[model samples]
Target chain A: MAQSNGTDVRLMKGNEALAEAALRAGMQAYFGYPITPQSEVMEYLTMHAPEHPGVVILQAESELAAINMVYGAAGAGARVMISSSSPGISLMQEGLSYMTSAQLPALVVNVQRGGPGLGTIQPSQGDYFQAVKGGGHGDYRLIVLAPASVQEMVDFVFDAFRLTEKYRNPAMILADGALGQMMEKVALPPVGSLPRSAAPWATVGKPATRERNIVTSLFIQPERMEQINLQLQAKYRTLEKEEVRCEQLQMEDADFALVAFGLTSRICQKAMELARQKGIRVGLIRPITLYPFPSAVIRKAAGQVEAFVTVEMNAGQMVEDVRLAVDGTRPVHFTGRMGGMIPTPEEILAKIEAVVAEPSLQHA
Target chain B: MKEPDVIEGMEVVYRKPQTLTATPMHYCPGCSHGVVHKILMEVVDEMGIQDKTVGVAPVGCSVFAYDYMNVDMQEAAHGRASAVATGIRRVLPDTYVFAYQGDGDLAAIGTGETVHTVNRGENILMVFINNGIYGMTGGQMAPTSLLGMKTSTSPYGREAAVNGYPLRITELLAQLPGAYYVTRQSVHTTAAVRKCKKAIEASFRYQTEKRGTCFIEVVANCPSGWKMTPNEANDWLEKNMFPYYPIGDIKAPKQ
Candidate 1:
């Protein structure tokens, strides 16, 4: 694979970018069960994973089993990854919570599809609350990266690993079915010869110098368990300081700003361009990290903008966070499409136009 | 002040060595889990593969078997140990991988996974314990429960009208082309315990040689669930369970 110039030209779907990124980021094991829109990732890994030393791949029995396999492999300190759609990802919540409580560093890719039930295989961002609020049980957080472009899909996975290891927490790449299926030109990263760090706690085998290490989340005592929870909260606090990321476009002199992430961010960007052409001074705040959410950036933009229009593939999930970030300093509006439907750039532009025309109509 | 008591001294010398960890087991007293665990450890010691072997513990009563077993181990989700073991063995082909599962975990929830894994000819060992009931979940009727056995959930004694007949997992698995060895053994008596150990050792040997998927189903006794003494449970297993479930090899690789 030849390295291309670092221009964000694209020719890959969101799922493809994730697969390539896992390979580039030195992932050694991939345990996955087939689910819609995310199946390509497993197919890609099955073919290319073996070329790299230490790469272990398997098609697990179920989404539940796949995540548990990830837990097992992650416990052994192998750079591991798992991918699924919304419903499948839901089944993995128990194992994900276990991973979080155990502080097991791993990557989870959710190519979200429409859902409340087995909703459709089409694209939707309905998992916003699930991802940002820590879908599984306990007072915990997963470092979530919402990528809007195919290029960012590849880049964010590499970033997810770095952040996961740094915080010892599970990191997620939240993409939608459109991003997963749509193809675009992507400049691949140059494969490097860097030696990866070996986790001392991973259970490869008991080396002569160290005692056998057992990775588990079962704490019998309440006080000791509470202490673990407190430690996890502290780690998430430190992560918020070091990991929050986002992209700001033309927010300096704007009357209204658009906030979005993942596939909707791309549509919002296009909407912003069209709104600018129409002389409606609008900008965008595209979140790169959904968990250590880009709150400060939004707060800063709130001072300069009169109103904020939050656009998403789901119905008003991330808008809540945007509202909290502005903290009533300015008006906030929400527009979204659920059930695997993508709101067009024209639709988003129309919503922005409506928000700017009647400032009093903005949501609190 | 007294001479050595030869009989007591000899008895102490011949006792089974404690290979399992000394932690207080959470299993109920008289439960067959301890007996099965002891036999498995003895087999590991006899085969001299404790260093190279890796065990996958399921989410049933044996979820914490890894905590006691003196080897590299992973805890798999309920009934998914075979799939997890498949992942471990594929990556570390030289390492012997085995999954320990219960009847509810194997024949009920994990049947599809286990069947497909064996059909794929994964070279791993599977140790299934069939106690005709779900002991961990308070005596629920399992897929292997006898026709008229009463359980907590089945207070009216399992009837053919409501519940189906017991499933013979060894017989079911033996029909698959990928399954190289399928056997049903028991650990109710001292003689049967020795046979169970030999069967476990043989399964591990099959995995080491890459023969194919080796399945050993142990007809264990859940005395507490059965509402019987340990000895009575053994007798009950011999009289009631064995005739129906039957003990013997269903399939073995040709020499």
Candidate 2:
């Protein structure tokens, strides 16, 4: 097979790239329940998974059970993954909390759809807080990656696995349904040659040389529990330093910049392109890693920019993080679309131009 | 005076306890969870598949069954152990997989999961524990609680008009073609415990032999929930729960 730069380019949807990337990343097992827009991930895995030895794919009874199975396989030192949409991911929060507290490394993909309750399943980025914040309970955080395109979807899966093992924590690819179902050109990573090592802490049953190992997060003593939390917090600090990733575009001389991530980022990028062509000094800061968020970069950019306009598919989740990063040095404006409706580049351009035109908003 | 020769009779040999290290059980005293755990471990030991066996434990009194079974164990969400087991088995076909669940967990909130798993003909074993009432949550009314049975949630006794009748999961699952073996056994007495062991072993064997889904529903007594002494609860199970949830092979592969 001919390869371009040793990677094969293929047209695929965000969901398809996730499945392909997971399999190529040595993910031997997948347990997921089917939900709209994101169901294609399960469908693809179901059709193709049995061809590979050690690869397991199952349509679980619910998102709750699927994530627990991920916990089981991850405990066994297997590269396991699961995928679902907004409400489905909500159902999985309890198990995800357990996985977090237990410090198991696994991958969870959330193809967000609209929801407060059983919302429509077209496309929405309503799970912003749920993905970056602990989503579940307790004092814990997940390594969240946002993929804006099919190529990033493929790349993020491999990165998620590597980071998960490196940190011994759960990682999430927070894509909305728009990215999940949309088709785009993606260069697939090579199946072999990728790193495939489990953490020494993983429980894969005892061998003759070692004593039995137990993987649990429960601590009866408050001091021990506090110690564990401190340890986890230290790990998070290390991750924050090493894993922050983002994409900066045209921010150097711009009067204002649009901050976005995932599919919304793509729209913002396009809007910035259109605005620049019209002589408007607008730029974009698209975050690639939602957790370990690129706060420092935003802080530096805020020094030169007049204002930061945060655009998202949800009402206002990531906006909070953006505001915190700016630290009130500059005004941070917000605009969003919920219930699976996506904002077009034209709409974002309008929002950006409106913010730039307002005299009071420009300097203060 | 010559002291009698004191000899410690040859030091007794103690085998490693056959329980999983993943869980430390929180089962109540005299709960049938211990018996069920022993039976499953004995089967794994006898079959020489301890290293290749994966068990899924559900919520309820038996939620911690993983803690006491010496094998790869997964603790599943309430009522969803079977679905989790299905995922494990699909990925590791050579590994013997089973789920241990309780009445309220499997037959109530998880009813759809259980029925659909069985209907899909998942080649996994299901060990259903029917203890008449919910044990972990302070004796709440369970799907298996009989009519006129009082519980914390059903203080006036489970009136047929209000609470609906008890669910017979074995008979219900046996109707599906995907089920290769379906049996209801008990652990109330010595003979019943033996029978339950046999049923559990049969279910495991069916999965090993690549048969369809094998389901064994064990009619157990929860003295804590029944508000009786262990012996009285066993006797109560014999008199009250047994007839409604009869013990027999609803479907079994031909010998």
Candidate 3:
């Protein structure tokens, strides 16, 4: 059953749940350019926004326009959001950076697809690095959340908006094509009463006694820019300690560990199940927050496991983080299924077995 | 003998607007940005909406617009001012929103945002400063750089084949039904400043009335970038740039 605080449970696509959850999280506006795997988000809002009073929905000419619109709305102190796929996400990188630097709170859902260019409409984990690390120019971080299920997609967007406001920083819900399109039971929470115009920092206009608020990142002075960067870095450090999240599964007694997130985490769950049934002790570490990267859990797992195998739908993007968490102490191997390819549970189970059985790694 | 005063009464012809801060702008001497900035703030003060106005500044010299304008302001990335303004207007439809941008920002890199924001008929004012060359990034050639004009990037004079043609953006935008008001003015002369100020005032009123997109293009002079004295730059602008970019209303709000 779906769960979210005495709300009705319904089977929904990840994208649809995201839209509903945004409404529940008190979204003032949603601006987006449609792309595969995430178009339903805009579609859902366009169809249902009339029923949700006071919520604004607009389709931008492009991702570039959509992101800038979000920046403007967020700067005005409106809780806004935008969603697109890989190629479209690439177009928004500049605006995303601006939003972060300007210290505007926003939500961006990048339902990743295969790409270095307009590669494919199918699912891929290629944007892990872009989402966790700085996607745009400059030194910045997006509070990155990776949702493994449709239910999680619903929950994470709400969490993202909360974290976005709490820190006054942009948060990214980095899902993939598989998760966005997949159907699962999701709980629709009660409608939030916080109005978009209620943002204390928002520019509803200057009042008689209040000072004007300027939302900008331009620091012409080198020292001032450095100070802003230092401040951002300090906030990031605090977030890392307070926000790191991961789900450890069947890790009590295991010789091998599978590190993955999003759809790959679901695949790893089955792989762990398959390995356990075959008398092979394997655990799964599903990182929910990619930025505050569940490194401590990996560090703890290093003492329990002899080897680590990271499985991804991309060319092993998240594996690099896995390796860093393991810190070269344990054998961290990778198996990628890119260009829309998915790793099967049996395949991942075999890869785990091979990690302990062989000196050289085996490909999936 | 009565204490004789040289002047019995002094009249105040002009005063800085309360909408503008006392902070000295970083604009170079003889730059049109200062004039354009003054007129806009004057409109804000005259309308008595300083608290209800939000300005979006471009990534060029006016990126520090927040430092000068005593209203809530946002600094947009190069060319995305219109897009940002659209967002603000959409959410806070009651508030007055405007974007201050340079030619490079409005015509070249930000061309898409500029065109689309106008085309959407967003209730925002766009004050475009067409200086013909990139000001903040030194004397680089811009999309509005005139034919045969020499820039740092176009050192041998702008060749239409190599450097491309100067884009008359406001004129082109006149074709869109969404842009209810489109005007091209200058900031060099006192008479022109008054006209521009009235145009800005009219536009601000239309914005409050929820009229469509209102665009005002100011053909400004750039002394430092053009390698001319402030006086020479004004003369050159009137002689050369004026003939090419004549000031007038390209379109007026639909009746």
Candidate 4:
């Protein structure tokens, strides 16, 4: 029996949860185009915008327009956000680079679908490289948060806003079709619980008290541009030191480890449990923040585990990061299903067993 | 203490608008961007909306517009100024928002944003500076480049067979219901400068009235891009560009 607190704990699709969280997190404006697996985010915001006074929801003409709108609203010092899937996210790379260059704080949600070119509307982690590698051009990094569940889909939205504002850079909530469309119980924050602090640097009609502020990414002079790039690199280093978050499940006395993130992490967890039932020592490392890769944890675990097996929905993206973290102390194995294919726990378990038997595959 | 309006025997009949920043503009000599920037800032000054105006600067020659415009400004990507202005205006509806773009930025790469922004009736002012060439990138042929005109990209004169027809985007946008006021003006002479100033002033007023989108296209010239002296460029503009892109209001608000 549930308490009648006006459906305080309600089952919600991950996309809906993300939209609800944005409103509650004091999102001032939302500009997005309709894209697969994430269009519900905009639809929910539009339908419920009336409940949140002064909240602006607009369906932009295209992803390019949507991203620029985010840039514009962010420059005006509003808590703004944009959501899109794979193909749409590709259109936003230029805008993302500009936002990062200007050091503007905003949120971008990528509910990823299979892609190389409009591949499928199904779940896949192919965008892991694109998200963490500064998908846009130039030397820039976005604070990428991987939410593995519907609850996290709601929670990371709030985290993204806070982190982006704190660092004065953009942040991304990287989910997938599975997490976006799946339904689960989530506790949405109370309305207006999170009030964003005023951004003094915002260009909202400069007052006489301060010199007018300019939000721009164009530093024409080569020397000046280099200086700006250095400044951005320094900020990214600080983020790496302070914001690396991950979940280590049942690592104590484990001889093997499985590393993954987002939806794949959930699947890996099930596989770990299956391996444990077979009298095998297996652990799971779920990286919540993909940008500041949890290298230290994986490196430390490498000394304890004989081998690591990475399971993903992509051809093999995050596996590279896993291999880099291991640093040859132990062999790192990878098993992936591409083009919108989900690896069953049994398949992942088999890979773990194979890695455990070989311990060091010559090609690993 | 504020300086006296009258210094010595000089009554100071004319002076730079306070809304125009002290930063030295990087525009080439005889570029219409400087005049347009001055006139637009003058409107911001005279209307006393300097503190309530947000400007969006486009990528072309005026990419450094934020350095010259005293008001809060955002420099948008090439051709994305109108979309950026839409974001700013929606967030701060009370603020007077405007986007300044060039022929290449507006009529070429940003045509989609410009058309859609006006179609949605975004309550902002869009200032288009059409020089018929890409000034910042060293005089490439722009979408608004007159046919038979030779540019870097069209070295052998723009042929109708090779290059598409010059786009009359201003007239095309005027047909949209969202365009509350659409006009084309220039700053070639004293009278033209005054008319261009009035158009900008009215555009801001219409923005405050929530009269959809107010677009003003200035048929200007680029001396460096056109490979001509400043005076030659102005003369060329009046003699050549005018015949194709006439100066006057193409659309106006109803009483």
Model 3 C-alpha lDDT versus the unseen true structure: 0.89
Compared with the true structure, what per-residue lDDT tens digits does model 2 show for residues B1-255? 222344476553533344444454577778888877877787777767766677777777766565577666667667777776776676667778888899988999889889988988988899899988999889999999999999998998999889888888789899999999999988777888888878877877778688689999888989888888889988898899888988889998899
lDDT of 3 at B131: 89
Query: How well is each residue in A1-364 modelled by candidate 3, as lDDT tens digits?
Result: 5565677799998889898888877888999998997999999999989878878899988899889999999998888999999999999999988888888899999999988898998999999889999899999999999999898888887788888888888999999998999899887767873433346677668777988888887887899999999989998999999998899888899788889999998888888888888898888888999998888999889988888999999888888888888898888999879887888998887787777677553332
TM per candidate comes to 0.91, 0.90, 0.95, 0.97
> What TM-score results for chain B in every one of the models?
0.92, 0.91, 0.95, 0.97
lDDT of 2 by residue, A276-303 (tens): 9989898789888899999999999999
DockQ (0 to 1) for model 3: 0.78
Error (Å) of candidate 1 at residue A165 is 3.2
**Model 4, position A324: C-alpha lDDT score:** 93
Error of 3 at B205 (Å): 0.6
**Model 1: which residue pairs collide?**
A9-A185, A10-A184, A10-A185, A10-A186, A11-A184, A11-A185, A11-A186, A12-A184
Model 2 steric clash pairs: A123-A340, B19-B68, B19-B69, B19-B70, B20-B68, B20-B69, B20-B70, B23-B67
What digit string (tens of lDDT, one per residue) describes model 1 on residues A10-92?
A: 46776877797788788888989999978999998888876777688888778877887787777666778999999999999
Over the stretch A1-364, how does candidate 4's per-residue lDDT look in tens digits?
Answer: 1434664677899999999999999999999999898989999999999999999999999999999999999998899999999999999999999999999999999999998898999998999999999998999999999999998998898999999999988999999999999999998877777668878989989788889999999888999999999999999999889999999999998888999999998998889999999988899999999999999999999989888888899988988999999988888889989888889999999998887777344344
What shift in Å separates residue A250 of candidate 3 from its native position after superposition? 0.8
Residue runs of model 2 more than 4 Å from their true location after superposition: A1-6, A199-228, A277-279, A359-364, B1-27
Return the candidate ranking by DockQ, descending. Answer: 4, 3, 1, 2
How much is A355 displaced in model 2, in angstroms? 2.9
Q: Which candidate number has the best lDDT?
A: 4
Model 2 DockQ vs. reference: 0.29
Cα displacement (Å) at residue B237, model 1: 1.3
